[model samples]
Target: MIKNEANARHLREANKAFKAIKSEKPMTDYAKAQQSIQENRERLKAERLAREVSSKDAAK
Candidate 1:
């Protein structure tokens, strides 16, 4: 029974260590660039939509 408990403890500790390692992976440079580009695209799209709405309101 004691051996089983020790094995469970070791497994839990190992899982916690591996989970920490997996969760803290740094983003690569290419991924960072892609994320930046996506953010810029979304911002531009929002601006364009706002402009179009204003223009339509002006025409009315």
Candidate 2:
């Protein structure tokens, strides 16, 4: 059936994508630095949001 063929094609594409991701090399130092910065930014943003919420609750 046509549906079956489409499903097979989708699976093949997905497998190829997974293989490509598995083949990637390790991150360079610059990439590591960028990832570290991104993680720190996310952590800081969460802290800032928590502080704002607490302050708003206190002011009520």
Candidate 3:
């Protein structure tokens, strides 16, 4: 037979997940994204430099 404890545990988990997702911020629009353009550019620049460094090291 199913037990009351099992049902409570399931409900608690479901509600916890629901609350977490509900609390998260939604996607940002282009204007909001542009606000972070400088940060994004720096991140991409760092990635490209890292790749170049690795390639030069491998060539040696």
lDDT of 1: 0.94
Residue-level lDDT tens digits of model 3 in 1-60: 378889989999999887755465665798578868978999999999999999999999
lDDT of 1 by residue, 1-60 (tens): 999999999999999887845465689999999999999999999999999999999999
Give the alpha carbon lDDT tens digit for every residue of 1-60 in model 2: 999999999999999887755467889999999999999999999999999999999999
Cand. 2 Cα-lDDT = 0.95
Candidate 2 residue pairs in backbone clash: none
Return the clash pairs for model 1, or none.
none
Stretches off by above 4 angstroms in model 2 are 1-21
Quote the RMSD, in angstroms, for model 2.
6.2
In terms of TM-score, the best-performing candidate is 2
Model 2 residue 31 lDDT? Answer: 98
Error of 2 at 16 (Å): 13
